[model samples]
Target: MLDSIKEVLITQEALQERVAELGKQISADYKGEEVVLVCVLKGAVMFFADLARSIEGDVTLDFISCSSYGNSTQSSGVVRIMKDLDKPVEGKHVIVVEDIVDTGNTLHYLLENLKSRNAKSVRLVALLNKPDRRTVEVHVDYQGFVVPDYFVVGYGLDYAEQYRNLPYIGILKEEVYQSK
Candidate 1:
């Protein structure tokens, strides 16, 4: 599948380093407090696993999967909750962990949903952010990389559910998705 990639945007080493750094910062910010990491599933799983190991203090992980895209390169602007968190986040310092924030629709919907649950606080931590595609204003408290408007895959990001197994993040060639 490397043949489908036009360029490598972030290497595996870089991604690991950044994630570790983010973990350190988050550990400092929430020191001595109970943290519930609500991981946005499927895509963010890889980052979530590594980050959880790096964190200090009391940390718990929950997963919620919301989808805005199917097999397309762009979001549909519609957010659907495929799976919800098993545990309630009420009265806890909750962090929404996402693989990428593109168009901001899904994340905004998720944040509002989580807030309505009576969580003491909610913040965002995204591995990648695409500001150019944002349709709504969303605050990302912590971020790994601000990527340009390119179709990226690998390291938990995917194209039609493929390329996610790749270790590094790379820009997918337009022709691959265009042919669909």
Candidate 2:
């Protein structure tokens, strides 16, 4: 699996350190409020688990699966909700957790949908952000890293659903995606 990677973009240690710090910030920010952590499914599965464990305050968790990239590098430009949150967010401080923000379409759609449901306050927490590729502006309250617009995989990110198990984030070789 290591042989397929062109280079390691972020080490496992670095990811853990950043996540821990994010947890601290979140704990402090929502210290006296009712907090609901919404995990965007699949890609954020790993991040949500780690973040949830690290947070110190009272927090409730829910998950919703959303998709824009259906087995492709770029989004289809239309976001769809494959699964919806089990609980309502009305008058609750909500934090939307995501693995990565690329084009920002999914986040924008999610933000609007959450607002329509009357959430008290909505904030974004993304593990990775590729600002160069953004087509829509997104406000990320807690961003792990600002990355270059390279196709990256691992730490819950994937390519062809094959690289999510990798411990570190790495740049996928071009040939892997271009092969006939």
Candidate 3:
């Protein structure tokens, strides 16, 4: 699988260090509140697990799978809830954990949906952010890194459902996408 990768974008050690720092900040900010982490699934599998462990206080965990990409690199500009949250978010200090923030459509849709559900407070915590590609205004409270626009894979991110198992984050070669 490594053969497919052209170069590593973010090393595993670098990601871990950043995650630890984010955990510290979150743990400090949410010192005396009921923290509930809603992890966006598939892509957030690795990020959610790592962030949850790094947090010092008690935090409730939940999962939701939403998608705007359908077998392509570009989003369809429409977000769909593939799997809704298992529990209601009313009166909870909800934090939406995401693997990457790209077009911002999914996060915007999610925030609106959560607000409609009457969550006490809602904020975003994304491990990676692609600022150049944002098509909509979205708020990201806790961000690990702001990256340039690139087709990145690994650390739960994927290309055609492959490369999620990679320990580090890497940018796919142009040929990989062009050939597809």
Best by TM-score: 1
lDDT of each: 0.94, 0.92, 0.92
lDDT of 3: 0.92
User: Which ten residues in a row are the worst by lDDT in model 1?
Assistant: 68-77
Q: Mark the regions of model 3 whose C-alpha exceeds 4 Å error after superposition.
A: none
RMSD to truth, every model: 0.7, 1.0, 0.8
Candidate 1 displacement at residue 49 in angstroms: 0.6
Pairs with backbone N, CA or C atoms under 3 Å apart (clashes), candidate 2 = none
TM-score of 3: 0.97
Which residue runs of candidate 1 sit more than 4 Å off their true CA positions?
none
The residue-by-residue lDDT of candidate 2 on 1-180, one tens digit each, is 677799999999999999999999999998977789999988888889899888888899999999999888889999999999999999999999999999999999998899899999999999999999999999999999999989999989988788998888899988887772
**Model 1, 59-156: lDDT tens per residue?**
99999999989888878989999999999999999999899998999999999999999999999999999999999889999999999999999999
Assess the local accuracy of residue 65 in candidate 1 as a C-alpha lDDT between 0 and 100. 93
Better model by lDDT, 2 or 3? 3
Model 2 residue runs over 4 Å out of place are none
Put the candidates in lDDT order, highest first. Answer: 1, 3, 2
Candidate 1 local Cα displacement, residue 126, angstroms? 0.4
Instruction: Assess candidate 1 and give its lDDT.
Output: 0.94
Using all chains and alpha carbons, the TM-scores for the candidates as numbered come to 0.98, 0.97, 0.97
